[model samples]
Target chain A: MLFVENRELVVPGRLLAEGDYFAGEGTFLEGGKIFSAVIGLAEIREKSISVISLQGRYIPRRGDRVIGIVTDTHPFGWILDLNSPYTGNLMVSELVGRKVDVFREDIGKFLRIGDAVLAEVREVDERWRVQLTASERGMGRIRGGRLVEISPAKVPRVIGRKGSMLKVLEETSGCRLEVGLNGRILIRGRDLKKVNAVVEAILLIEREAHLSGLTDRIKAKLEREG
Target chain B: MAEAKPEKLLVDGRRLDGRRPDELRPLRIKAGILKRADGSAYIELGKNKILAAVYGPKEMHPRHLQQADVAVLRCRYNMAPFSVEERKRPGPDRRSMEISKVIREALEPVLFLHLYPRAVIDVFIEILQADAGTRTAGITAASVALADAGVPMRDLVAGISVGKVDGTVVLDLMKEEDQWGEADMPVAVMPRRKCITLLQMDGNFTPQEFRQALDLAFKGVEQIYEAQKEALKEKYLPSLEEGR
Candidate 1:
């Protein structure tokens, strides 16, 4: 039995459901009962129950696209700060897509500290060591763009349902967006004003992600200002 | 102040504070009070004012302190120099150190620490004004702060100090009762499970009085549990309303 309506706010330990409910993010099951593990809105999708958390740091998972800042370099790879608890390790081979003799090539030529790169989380080991790969097209060092970061938990809302929000953002503003699951976004546009307007819209979304009719509001705002 | 104990602590079934044996002090809790903190809460219970802030699930510093399978939970309980009647020396004292350790233990069971290995979650509890029962109030606020930080936990912990004063079992002790009471017991409970995570005693209690005190503590904890949940909602409810 579901005890809460969809999008109803719940606090930790509040009983959410009972009997055959699959616990999703921000929720846990205990002895035939399901309870919320964080303060957020309870979401019920079919038979699965989850709470969309309003606040939290990003925890790296496989196949997630993230933006990372190169921080340190070692013999075989470089360490990238993923804006999370775990750092992402991108090998020289992973970035170059081929094995090269580290002794012969200066790895620093490809990427240096403070250079932001768009990459995919390839693997997260049992120890939470994150391995990143930027071999795909448009997934290398970021050269020029405006970077805006909000809470990682709100990233999904920015994307909206089935990329609808992202489409609205790009179509209306005439800008391109690369949204990282780790709460970092890159906006590139020929017109600086349109890009800044998109940035403002994104910030407004982050602040009001929990509200309904947000996508329409954002679309209207972008059409007006962009 | 070193004032002498009063001859009578209770008259007409009213303690010095004019509260009944089963009455609790006024408690107010606010969540997400600090702009910079990942999560923060301010709690005022009677004269006890405490602020708790939680930062992390971030990278743990000092490589050796990192846990292989679980995040390390660190707590610091500090009282402001002007918090008490006598000016307290700033920094960790023996009493505050002990309280910090106990508070960490009280909150540890509820957290899913294994979810974030090699990370550290720091809980800082500052006593801005204290009139006894500060440790219990601190625990109450710290739990809310942790939840506010979006840390996954099985439950929230609520705490209160109960004791025997003037040979009468009382719920929620004030400074005077704590100082002159026969037995003071601070108890923390995960109310959902009815499990005790922290239990400490100072002074003596008869078996009957201990059982009564424990019952009273649980009742007090239930009230605190409601307030904790209410505080968390209060922080987010405004946005929730505006969304509609």
Candidate 2:
């Protein structure tokens, strides 16, 4: 039995469904009933019931592309702050793409503290130890782009459905965007004016992500300002 | 100011505040009131104004304090120096410390702490103004703040204080009643399952009076739980409705 409609705003402990429903993220099952575990919009997809939370810190998951900042260096690896409660560790081999003897070479040559790197969450253990890899093309240390961070929960709105909002952002402003699920967006453009326009639009999106017609407003703003 | 106690707390079934024995104070709750905190709420029950903020599950500080298998829940219950009639000491005193511990325990059962291992969730409840029943109000506001923070929980907690004044069991005690009454019991409940989370009494109650007080507290909790849900919806639903 379904208790809440699709996309209905629900608070914690509101019953979402019952019987054969599989509980998904933001929901829990107890005594044959599925209930929302956070304040979010309930999503009923076929046999599964889940709630999409509107606010929260980003939790690292495998295969998520993220932007991390180097905060510490170790003999064999470096610790990268993922803008999350947990930090991601990038081994020297993962960044250099090959084994380099820690005793023979100073790993500091490849990366240093305060350097921003575009990396992928390669693995997250049961204990929440995150391992990141940056060896792939366009995945190493980020060099000349303006970074804007917003609430991680709003990253999906910036991406939009099937990357439509992203395409609008890029096409309207003429600025390339690298959006991290962790809420860090890197914008690069040859024209400073267009880059600033993109930054403003991103902030606007973050502020009004829950409103309708946001993508159109962003597009119109970028076209007028960029 | 020490004043003479009224000869009778109730006159013709009404208390000094012109309320019935079972009446509650006017309540107003607003969620997401603080912009900086991850989640926050401001609540006013009659003259008591309280603000509650939740700032985690973030990385726990002081490495040794991090629990290996679950996030640590910490609560701080503070009263502004001017919140009371007499100036309260600015910092955490013995009473506030005990309230803080009990508040944390009251809220811990609802949270899915194990989901955020090696982290800490901090709940800070500030009593901006006090009449009476601030601790129970704090628990009620803190639970809403936790939900506002998007912390996963099985249920939300609601609380109320019931007591006896003039040998009559009453619901939602006022400042005068709390100060001069024969018994005061603060009870917190997980309203969804009717589970009692925090129950404390600081005076005398007969066994029958205790049962009546418990029932009254549950009734108050039901009303508070509804208000809590409404507050959460009021903060997040307008945007959600427009988006759809």
Candidate 3:
């Protein structure tokens, strides 16, 4: 029953009462009287009302791997842009398990700006800054390849169920495909035609991510077009 | 106000393209037009086209502002440089900011922000054309997008513009009227409540003239609202049957 003031029902909740204002989502009512703004639809379930509000951009979560670009470097960590409004930081300590000898001046030699890296969004600190780590294998500076940026929300769809989509893209394009959880995709190939083909495939995946049987259809398209 | 000398009428007593006052230009709306956005729609009103995307009631982060009670509405209104006759500079400007603020307010009354406290809902409206009433068009487009996204709302909000041109009140003013008209008023309202969530008027208007203009806008809004609902129903009704 959650709704916006003049939009459609976004969330299905319950109808609480008839009113002119919306009282946020999860609003409580007693004696059949609404006590909040009726901005969204009022869902009446047993004894409570829920309001559905608008949607926001995606944020990184724990255990989520993402593709990020190095934005800045500091003694302790390197700042990375996850293509989100918020940037994440990767600590040098997290990069290596064992402490290694390194001077402050030499930190830049290890990781420089614009170097695309794969990492995990560990946690958001109290200040809401994202912290990342790239200690795992298959997660590090992306080697020579073409990069494509897609909507972060489409990443899950592009990855498909259990890495199936990536497998298909790699097989068809004849390129090594690496999808960062943060929505950065890297297609590694020497042939320009193959690289362009892979990019087109990824874009197609992004554009048609919502429909069922998308992977199979995309495979067919690639087989025919490639 | 120093009146800019009336440039010879583009058409005798007719708007450019020859439409009369109170006449609506062709309108076409398509919902669920974008794949990545949770809900998206493209709207073409006369020569003006706009796309709107709606995303979330997910998790409210930053921990500090997280209200267990409501969601935040973050609206960004942008116009592509190619949207207008003259290329607009890319990025937010004073005009765009004002439109964004107005649109946010227009949508705020409809969203159940308290439900996802500390969480944020982002509505991005992109103008692909700029004939006139882009703000109203953007609002109308966003309303359909929210529906397409499945965001719950009490009712559909409709937006329309009214202006005074040559001492005459007109509905759905075009670009010329907007530039030379004595007043331009854009309103966003929840047709069900008959209440306005967004209202802005630029230019002079006598009390009677203002009332007349508002009435004209409301009439135009009813027509626009019907169009919005019909477009959404046409697009989503099929999904409903499939679910059944």
Instruction: Name the top DockQ candidate.
Output: 1
Ranking of models by DockQ: 1, 2, 3
TM-score of chain A of 1: 0.98
Candidate 2: docking tier = medium
How do all the candidates rank in terms of TM-score, highest first? Answer: 1, 2, 3
Across B1-244, the per-residue lDDT of candidate 1 in tens digits comes to 6999999888889999899999999999999999888899999999999999999889998979999999999999999999999999999989999999999999999999999999999999999999889999999999999999999989999999999899999999999999888989999999999999999998889899999999999999999999999999999888889977
What DockQ, on C-alphas, does every prediction get? 0.80, 0.73, 0.06
The TM-score between candidate 3 and the true structure equals 0.60
TM-score of each model, in listed order: 0.97, 0.97, 0.60
lDDT tens digits, residues A26-112, model 2? 999889899999998899999999998888888999999999999999999899988888889999999989999999999889999
Q: Which run of 10 residues does model 2 chain B get worst, by summed lDDT?
A: B235-244
Q: Who wins the TM-score comparison? A: 1
lDDT of 3 by residue, B1-244 (tens): 2446466423566765677767677888887788788788898888898999987655445656555456677789999988887788999999999889999989877765654445667799999888898899899889888766655565678898888887777788777788877889998888866789888998989999989988888888888887886776676444333322
Most accurate candidate by lDDT: 1
Model 2 accuracy (lDDT, Cα):
0.93
Of the pair 2 and 3, which is ahead by DockQ?
Answer: 2
- Candidate 2 local lDDT, B1-244, one digit each (tens): 5988999899999999899888889999999999899999999998999999999888888979999899999999999999989998899999999999999999999999999999899999999999999999999999999999989999999989999999999988989999999999999999999999999998999999999999889888888999999999999877777776
